[model samples]
Target: MDHIRRLLGRVTAAALTLLGVSVLIFAALRAMPGSYTELVLGPLATPEQKASAAASFGLDRPVAEQYGHWLRNTVTGDFGTSLVTRSPVASEFADRLPVTVTLTVLALALTLLIGVPLGVYTATRAGGGRGGAAGRLLSAFGMSLPEFVLGSLVVFLFTRYRLGLSVGTYTPWSEGPLASAGSLFLPACVLAVFCTAATARTTRDAVLGVLVEPHIAAAVARGEPKGFIVRHHVLRNASVPVLTLVATLSAYLLGGAVIVERLFDVPGLGSYLVDGLDRRDYAVVQAGVLLAATVFITANLLVDLLSGLLDPRLATAAKGAA
Candidate 1:
C-alpha cells in the first residue's frame, strides 16, 4: 500500500512538473520579440494576409485557449504542424528521435561499462589512493572540458590521426546496422567522455567509503578473495549512489546530446529543435521541449522506483511516512 501511494505521488508530481514546463514554454515562445505571423507568411505579406494566417494558426485565439487546444492535441501525439515547414511535429520526431535515442543509449552503455570496472578497480586500491589518484586526474580533465569543445577536439584528433573516419556524415540504418553503428561510434564516444568521468568519480568515492565498513574489514581480515568482497558487497551498496548519479546525469546528457548531434551533423531531435528555435517555429519548440520533459519525468520516476527496490530501507521509510 505504501509503495502504491509513493508511486502515485511520484506520478502526480511528474505530471505537475510537466504541466508547469509546458506553461513556461508556451509563455516564453509567445513573449519572444518576433511575429509568428510574418514567420509563416512573408515579410512583404499584406496586413490582411498576416491576420488571416494568424487566425488560421490559432494565433488570433486567446492564449489560454490556444494552450488548451495544443495540450489536447499534444496528448495524442498530434503536436500540431510546424509554422515554418507546414508539416506535423510528430512526423519530424518520428524521423529524427531514433538517432538521438541510439546515441544516448550507446553512450550510457559505454559509460557504465568503462566507468564501473575502472571505479571498482581503483576503489579496491588503498582507499582510492594510487589508482583513484590517476582516475581523478583523468576525470578532472575530462569534466573540465565543455561538450562542444570536447566534441571538436575529438573530431579533430579522429580526422587528423585516425583512418577511415567520416567527421560530419551520419549514416542511416538503411545502409546496414553495422554501418549505422559505425557512424554513431564517434558521437557516442564524445558523449561518453563526460558521463564516464563523472560516473567513475562518483562510483569510486561511493565504493571507497563502503570498503572501510566493519563488515568489509572483517571480510578482508579473513583473507577472502578481494574480487568476491568487492563484487558482492561493494557494488551492491555503492550502486545506490552510483545509480542516483546516473539518473541525474541522464537529464544533463540531453543538453550534451544536442551539441554532439550538431557537431556530428546527425539528423536527430537536437538538430530538429535547433532548427525550430532558429526559425521561431512554436509548434516544433513546444513539442520538442514537451518530449524532453516527458523523457525526464519517466526516467526520474523509474530511477526512484528502482532505488527503493534495490535499497529496502527507502521503502521502509516511505511506509513509515505513510
Candidate 2:
C-alpha cells in the first residue's frame, strides 16, 4: 500500500512537472522577438501573407486562447502540424523515438558492463594493487574529456586503423545488424565513457565504506569466502549509491547521445531536434523536448522503484508513512 502511494505521488508530481515545462516552453518561444510567422514565410513575405499564415496556425488568437488550444490539442495527441514537415508532431516523434531509444539503451548497457567492474576492482584492491591507481587515472581522464573531443578521437583512431568505417551514416539493423551495430559503436562508446567513469567512482566509494563496517569484518573472520563477503555484504550496501550514479549517468547519457548521434549522423531524436531548432520548427522542438523529458522522468521513476525493491527498509519506511 505504501509503495502504491509513493508511486502514485511520484506519478502525479511528474505529470505536473511536465505540464509546467510545456507551459514554459510555450512562453519562451512566444516571448522571442522574431515572428515564427516570418520564419515559416520567406523574409520578403508581405504583411498580408504573414497575417494569413498566422491566422491559419491560430497564432492570430490571444496568447491564452492559443495556449489553451495548443494544450487541448496536445492532450488529445495532436501536437499541431509541423511548420517544417507539414505533418503532425506526434507522427514525427513516433518516427524518431525508436532510433533514440535504441541508441540510449546500447550506450547504457556499455556503461554498466564496463563501469561496475572497474568500480568493484578499485574498491576491493584499494591501495593494494596497481589496478587502483589505473582506475583513478581513467576516471580523471573520463571526467576531463568532453564528449565531442572524445568522439573525434575515436573516429580518428577507427578510420586511421583502416577499420574501413565512418560514424556519420546509419545502416538499419533489419538490413544488416552487424553493419548497423558497427555504425553505432563509436558514438555509443563516446556517450558511455563519462557515465562509466562516474559510476565507477561512486561504486568504489560505496564499496570502500562498506568494507570498514564491523559486520563486514565479522563476516571476513567467520571463514566466509572473500567473494561471498564482497558480493553479498559490501555490494548489497553499496548498491544505493551505485544505483543513483547509474540513474544520473543514464539521463545524461541519453541527452548527451544527441551530440554523438549528430556527429555520427544518426537519425535519432538528438539529430532531429537539432534540425528542428535550426529551422525554428516550434512543433517539432516541443515534441522532441517532451519526448526527452518523458524518457528522463520515466527512467527516474524506474530507478525509484528499483531502489525501493533493493532496500526493504526504504519500502518499509514508505509503507509506514502511508
Candidate 3:
C-alpha cells in the first residue's frame, strides 16, 4: 500500500508538471516574434490569405481554446500534422524514436560495462587494496573531457587510422547486426565517456564510505579476504549511489545523444529535433520536447522506486517525511 501510494503521488506530480510544460511551451511559442503566416506563406502573401490561414489553423482563437485544442489533439495522438512535412506528427515520431532509443540504450550499456567495473576497482584500491595511482589517473582523465571533444577525438582517431570503426554509414540492425554495431560504436563511446566519469566518481565515494564502517572494519579484522569484502560488503552498500548515478546518467545519455547523433549523421530524433528547430516546425518541436520530458520523468520515477527497494531505510524515511 505504501509503495502504491508513492507511485500514485509521483504519477500525479508528473502529470501536473507535464501540463504546466505544455501550457508554457504553447504560450512561449505564440509569443515568438514571427507569425505562422510569414513562415508558411511568404512575404507577398495577401492580408486576406494571412487571415484565412490563421483562422484555418485556429490560431485566431483565444489562447486557452488553442491550448485546449492542442491538448485534445495530443491526447488523440494527432499532433496536428507538421507544417513543414505535412506528415502526421505521430508518424514522424514513430520513424525517429527507435533510432534515438537504440543510441540511448547502446550508450548506456557501454557506460555501465566500462564504468561500473572501473569504479569498483578504484573503490577497492581506495579501500587500501592492491591497485595503484594508474586507475585514479584514468578516472580523472575520463572525467575531465567533454562529450563534444570526445566525439571529435573519436572521429579523428577513426579517420586517421582509416579504422573500420569509422562511421562511414549507418545500417539498421534489422539489416545486419555487425554492420549496425560497427556504425554505432564511435557515437556510443563518445556518450559513454561522460557517463563513465560520473559513475566512477560516485562509485568510488560510496565504496570508500562503506569501507570505513565499523562492521566493515570488523570483517577485515576477522580475516575476511579482500575479494570477499569487495563482493559482499563494499558492493552492497555502494550500490545506492551507483544506481543513482547510472539512472541519472541514463537520462543524460538520452538527451545528450543529439550531439553524437548529429556528428555521426544518425537519423534519430535528436537529428530530427535539430531539423525541426531550423525549419520552425512547431509540431515537431513540441512533440520532441514532450517525448524527452516523458523519458526524463520516467527515468526519475524508476530511480526513486528502485532506491526505495534497494534501501528500505530510505523508503521508511520518505514515508515518514510524507
TM-score of every candidate: 0.92, 0.91, 0.90
The predicted structure with the larger lDDT, 2 or 3, is 2
Which residue runs does candidate 1 get wrong by more than 4 Å? 39-45, 126-129, 160-162, 254-256
Indicate whether candidate 1 or candidate 2 has the larger lDDT: 1
TM-score of 3: 0.90
Name the candidate that leads on TM-score: 1
lDDT of 1 by residue, 108-209 (tens): 899999888877776776453677678778777777879899899878887788667788888887788788888998898888988898888888899988
For candidate 3, write residues 223-272 as lDDT tens digits. Answer: 99989988987787678878877766666666547888877888878778
- Name the top lDDT candidate: 1
Worst 10 residues of 3 by lDDT: 126-135
Q: How many residue pairs clash in all the candidates, one count each?
A: 0, 1, 0
lDDT of every model, 2 decimals: 0.83, 0.79, 0.78
Q: Whole-model lDDT, candidate 2?
A: 0.79
